[model samples]
Target chain A: MKAIGSFKGEPITDSDSLVDVEVPTPDLAEHDVLVEVKAVSVNPVDTKLRAGAPSQKEPLILGFDAVGIVVKTGSNTTKFSKGDRVWYSGTTKRPGSNEAYQAVDERLVAKAPRSLTDEAAAAMPLTSITAYELLFEKMGANFGQLANPGKTLLIVNGAGGVGSVLSQLAKWAGFTVIATASPANFDWLRANGVDQPIDYHDDLETQVQGLGHHFVDAAVILYDVPSYYDAVTKLVAPGGHIGAIVGTQAKLNMEQLKSKSLSLDWEYMFAKGDFDFRMETQGEALRQIAQLVDNNFVHTTLSRTIDSGLNAKNLREAHQVVEEGHVVGKVVVSGPFNGQVNE
Target chain B: MKAIGSFKGEPITDSDSLVDVEVPTPDLAEHDVLVEVKAVSVNPVDTKLRAGAPSQKEPLILGFDAVGIVVKTGSNTTKFSKGDRVWYSGTTKRPGSNEAYQAVDERLVAKAPRSLTDEAAAAMPLTSITAYELLFEKMGANFGQLANPGKTLLIVNGAGGVGSVLSQLAKWAGFTVIATASPANFDWLRANGVDQPIDYHDDLETQVQGLGHHFVDAAVILYDVPSYYDAVTKLVAPGGHIGAIVGTQAKLNMEQLKSKSLSLDWEYMFAKGDFDFRMETQGEALRQIAQLVDNNFVHTTLSRTIDSGLNAKNLREAHQVVEEGHVVGKVVVSGPFNGQVNE
Candidate 1:
């Protein structure tokens, strides 16, 4: 099987940063399915892991979101069968989808949306799972046939990947969505169901308040956590939830949240995979997301496509596009395994 | 009406740290009940609010937990009638519960336990509300007749006011309770239904691990938050809840929580009262706590009582006992308002 990997932590511009190599096709565990990855999407985690030296003896395969077909299944696998189309953001601890074939726990893999292309399906899994988990699970937002829609949600970076999906979900749940972006992406934010789009370059707190929201029911910080932690605490109502997808080693003045008795929710989409805890829920969440997509309630967030297919060059270009930090939605690379392979 | 108050942020040793002052009896708002406070309990919030200089022109009266008799009820108040025995931890925004007569919202007052003394009833509210909110509400702990008993809860500072009540509630919910206290209070922890007691002086992580728990399902820090935040983070399982009631001005390494997708829940019992958001819930929680007490599922945490009554001297004694720390359970000052009165 051909896989593009970073042998060492290096800039994307370095030719050796991502190189094609041959590796044995992954063996299936009892609950595993061997998937032939058909398409892949580049995310911030992909860039982050790419910039770090791999802990494994093998080179780091940098990918998360993928639409693939089940090639084989382990003896105990029950959720998926061979030839079934699937989409998943596989475990961060294991080899990723930037490969011709990969073994993934069947519980974490869900059927790909029939209405979307492989590239589009690949773009939705990681960000969709992240947004869903943070909004419903971590933040404990309530939604039913008749949930109160008077509640408001603030997304710090609404034009980004997770933000784009989360805003749509929040809108579907009938929440008032206030999101942040530069003036240039205001239209994009509005199109994605953002009720109010505040300029990122301007004062976020002032702008949010200027829009007449004294405090949001919850605020999900999809970007720099430390920079937004204080403001989010202030913007959230007493006893509200504040969700963060970003990590920072720098200390935070968490006491600001104390007076309001707020909750800080950290959403690392791969936590279930890393701990081997509740992996089936990811598949279930993706199934729900797929249903929403097929129903036209939610649309795929794929904004850029590298039809040149999944080679080292296309993978590198996808990483570079995400690294530039202003990509509107998601950048996906379709697959034909044009990357190098050992004879 | 006579009250014991702190006009300045002064040491307990200072003669004027707590002084007898005459203040006007408060009038009732639409939802208010005028209560003649019979007994009061000292809590950390009482001490904390006492330490701070009041923003209002009046001296700060620092009582929170009180058992009283409704002397009058406002036109809109329906929950209480004159002569009704009630228990409450009223809002910090108001004058608090340190006077001969205090006007409080009916929604923040619940019927006092018939089986307990005024002092005993008074000792339960502030801590019980804190514990209930932290355990059930903030942590989102599931509790029912047949809730999964497999979950484990860690209570840091297990012999303190909130810890004493919280441990019992956790036990009732069938949780395996792990609590921290001085070696001297091991018996108290056991008596309070803690399955495992770890010494606070020892290495908490090593001790917790030695007891065969890689992680606890939830941990509530009843004491210093900054000092325990790191260890609590390490001790909580992936996607578990870490609850805190103490506020700290110092910054915390909140990033460590990102990997496990953990949640930090801050439970300030006064949040509802302070914000006027859902004051009715506090009364309902107290009613539940009362039922638990009557059913013998819980007990008053009061250990010592200042039968000398709620005067400047006795109030100072209770404050001193609390400020000294390490006392098991809670301390209370029975009240008949024997302080100086304006003629």
Candidate 2:
């Protein structure tokens, strides 16, 4: 089997940062399904794990979002069968989707939207899963039946992968969306269902107040969280929520959140998969997302596609684009594995 | 009107820490009610404000929980009429309940429990409001009709004012309550509906794990939050909630909460009255609490009562007891104002 991975953490600029290798096929667990990966998206998690990977004897493959076909299933698998097309943002605790054929838990697999291409579908799973859990699970927002008409949500980094999908989900829930991005990406924000896009370089509190909202009902920081924590605490109304996806080693001034009775929701989608806590919900969330897509309630966020295939070169380019930190939606590497083994 | 208050922040041991003062009655707002305070409770908030009081010329009266008779009602008040017995944990933004006559928002007042004594009812309001909000509003625990069987709640400082009531509420919600307290207070914890009470002096993680639970479903820090942050973080299960009532100025290592995707819920019940976010909810919460009390679903946490009345001497003694931080439940002062004005 062909695989692209790293033995040690290195800068994306290095040629060996993401090199091709040949490995034996993985043995399936009872709940596993063997997927022939068709398309995979490069996300911040991919870049983060790649750059900070521990020095290990075995290569650490890193890709979470994938649109693939089920080639085989373990004896106990139930939801997926051989030849069924599936989509998932698999767990990083085990080997991920950056392989020719990968084994994943059936509980985390879902049917991809029939209305979109593999590359377009690949761009959404990881971000869509993250956005859904953060909004519905962590922040406690209603997704379908009831509408949050007067509710407002402020999305920091509204042009990034998660933000691009999160703002759309908030709009679907009938929330007045206030997002932050560069001036050039304001149109991109609006296209993604952002009601108002304020420049991140400007004062967020003043900008939100200028929009006639005293405080946002909810705020989610998809970008650098530590730097934006204080600014966000000030803009969220008392008894509101402030959610974050990024982890920070630095200690945050948690006192600022106490006065207003704010809840700091940390959404790490991988937690459920790694800890075996409600892993089935990931599949359910993806199914709901697919329904929304097929019905035109939401659209795919694939902005760029590497049509040359999922080679080491194309994967590195995708990683570099995501690492630059200004992507409007998502970048995907499509086609079959064409990486020539370095050996 | 007569009151017992502090001129500035001082050690509770000082004779002048709490002194008698005479002041004019406050002007009532459109929704304000003038109450004849019958009983008042001494909580951590009262002592905290006294210990950290700013340099102000006007004496700052510090008491939140009170059982009183509505002596007068404002023009727009609808919830309460003159002569109604009321119970309320008023806001710290205005003059508190330490005076003979105090003006409070009618929306923040509720009918006191018909079965309990004035002193007994006084011990509940402030702590009840805080605990109710922490469990139901912040942590999203099901109350009333739903019984959260098999769910577990860990309460730090179980023998204190908030912890005593919080454990009872958790028990009523069908949660197995694991509480932390001094070895001397274990019996008290049991009396207050704590399923298990561990010593705070020992390793909390090992103790909680020893009880056959790898993690608690929900955790609340009623004691010092900053010191207990990491230990509590480790004990909470993935996707669980960590609720805090105490405010922390020190920075907290938030990364510990990221891997589990936990939520840090800071419950400041006064935020509603302080910021005017949802003043009506306070009254509603108290109403539900009163029903629970009258129905014997829960009992009052008042363990000690100063029958010497709400004079400067009795008030100082109550403040000293709370400041020491080892009381079994709540310490309250009952009877009319007997403070001899310093003038």
Question: Which candidate wins on lDDT?
Answer: 2
To one decimal, what is the Cα RMSD in angstroms of model 2 from the true structure?
2.4
lDDT of 2 by residue, A130-220 (tens): 8999999888787783378899999999998899999888998899999999999999999999999999999989899999999889999
Name the weakest run of 10 consecutive residues (lDDT summed) in model 1 chain A.
A140-149
Evaluated on CA atoms against the true complex, candidate 1 attains a DockQ of 0.70
- Residue ranges of candidate 1 with Cα displaced over 4 Å: A54-58, A143-148, A339-343, B51-58, B143-148, B339-343
TM-score for all models, in order of appearance: 0.94, 0.96
Native contacts retained per candidate?
0.78, 0.79
The per-candidate TM-score of the B chain, in the order shown, comes to: 0.95, 0.95
Best by DockQ: 2
Clashing pairs in 2: none
| DockQ (model 2, Cα) | 0.73
* lDDT tens digits by residue: candidate 1, B1-343: 8987888777777778888888888878999999888899888777766777754457788788999899889989889888999999999888888888888999998999888999888889989998888777778777553264789999999999999999999998889999999989999999998999999999999999999998888899888888998999988988889998887777776667888899999988888888887789899999998988888888888899998777888888888889888678888888467755432
Each model's lDDT: 0.87, 0.89
Residues forming the 10-long window of minimal summed lDDT in candidate 1 chain B: B334-343
